[model samples]
Target: MDELIDHSFKLIAKILYFLVRIFAWLIFEFLYEEIAWWLGWCICRAITLNSRPTVGINGYDEATTTTRFVVCFTGIATIILAGTILAIYISANAT
Candidate 1:
């Protein structure tokens, strides 16, 4: 009887693990796309805001514009990554 119970528990744990992985993937998939879009937007807005539409590859100023774009992109990516990790932790513990 003890062996049977252990086997059943293992099966349940496996199922739960698979479900949790799927849940995390679905959540992160949407977030990943949104982050890509935000990165693009960040690049565009930085250029527009500073009235500097020139790109580095196309004769734009190298130092200032690139610095601004990289800073904004990195900040946004870091925040989103931290949030996603927090969400995964919460999801695992909640179960």
Candidate 2:
């Protein structure tokens, strides 16, 4: 009985790990890629057109800014969001 319980626990742990990994990959591929690419494109285009857009309260662009700032901001935002999500999962699962 004890061995069975331990095996069950191990299986559950493996499943959880797999789920988290899949979730992370999906987020990186879909959410992260979309936001990063869109931001990169917007930043490059703004730089090409010579516009100065500032970071809005929610990180939206009322106008635009330099390529460096745009890419930096987008990267930072993506990291922050991804980290926040990972933190939430970690904290929730911590026992």
Candidate 3:
């Protein structure tokens, strides 16, 4: 009985660890840059009031300093937002 319980706990731990790894990969590898670029584009469009193209005439090959700043800011903001939500969730669920 004790062995069975120990095995079950280990399995649960492994599952949780796997899930965390996948989540981290999704956030850091897959979604972070894409989300940042999208948000930055939107913010730039808003700031420019759609008066001009945010991208260069050469297309996305060029990025203005302001655009870079917006992208970096949005990326950091996203990390902070995710951390805040995770903290709230963990605290709420804490025993």
Candidate 4:
């Protein structure tokens, strides 16, 4: 019985580890792509006149420098926070 319990625990742990890894990968990829898109938009807006005519917070000309800065900072901070959470979760499960 004890041996069976030990094996079951090991199997469950391995499954959890794999699931966590997949989840983390998907999350990070999504976040990184989003960040890249935002930063690219910021750069393109700052550099040239080639921008789509749209009116919103993300519009190239509609945003002030401070707004852009805040947006960029928020994106970066979100990525960092996600990384920190992933690290903490994985470490906690590793035991």
Model 1, 38: alpha-carbon shift in Å? 4.7
TM-scores of the models, in the order given = 0.44, 0.52, 0.43, 0.45
State the lDDT of candidate 3 residue by residue for 1-95, as single tens digits.
Answer: 99999999999999999999999988864454566666656655667787544574233337776665566476568668889999999999999
Better lDDT candidate (2, 4):
2
Over 1-95, each residue of candidate 1 has an lDDT whose tens digit, in order, gives 99999999999999999999999998765454345334544555575784533334222234366554554465467678889999999999995
Total backbone collisions for each predicted model = 0, 3, 0, 0
Best by TM-score: 2
Q: After superposition, how far is residue 82 of candidate 4 from its true place, in Å?
A: 16
**RMSD of each candidate?**
11.9, 12.0, 9.3, 12.8
Residue 21's C-alpha lDDT in candidate 4? Answer: 100
Of candidate 1, the 10-residue stretch with the lowest lDDT total is: 52-61
Of 3 and 4, the candidate ahead on lDDT is 3
In model 4, residue pairs whose N, Cα or C atoms come closer than 3 Å (at least 3 residues apart or on different chains), thus clashing, are: none
Clashes of 3: 0
Lowest lDDT sum, 10 consecutive residues, model 2, at: 54-63
In model 3, residue pairs whose N, Cα or C atoms come closer than 3 Å (at least 3 residues apart or on different chains), thus clashing, are none
Give the Cα-based TM-score of candidate 4 against the true structure. Answer: 0.45
Q: Which one wins by TM-score: 1 or 4? A: 4
Score candidate 2 by lDDT: 0.64
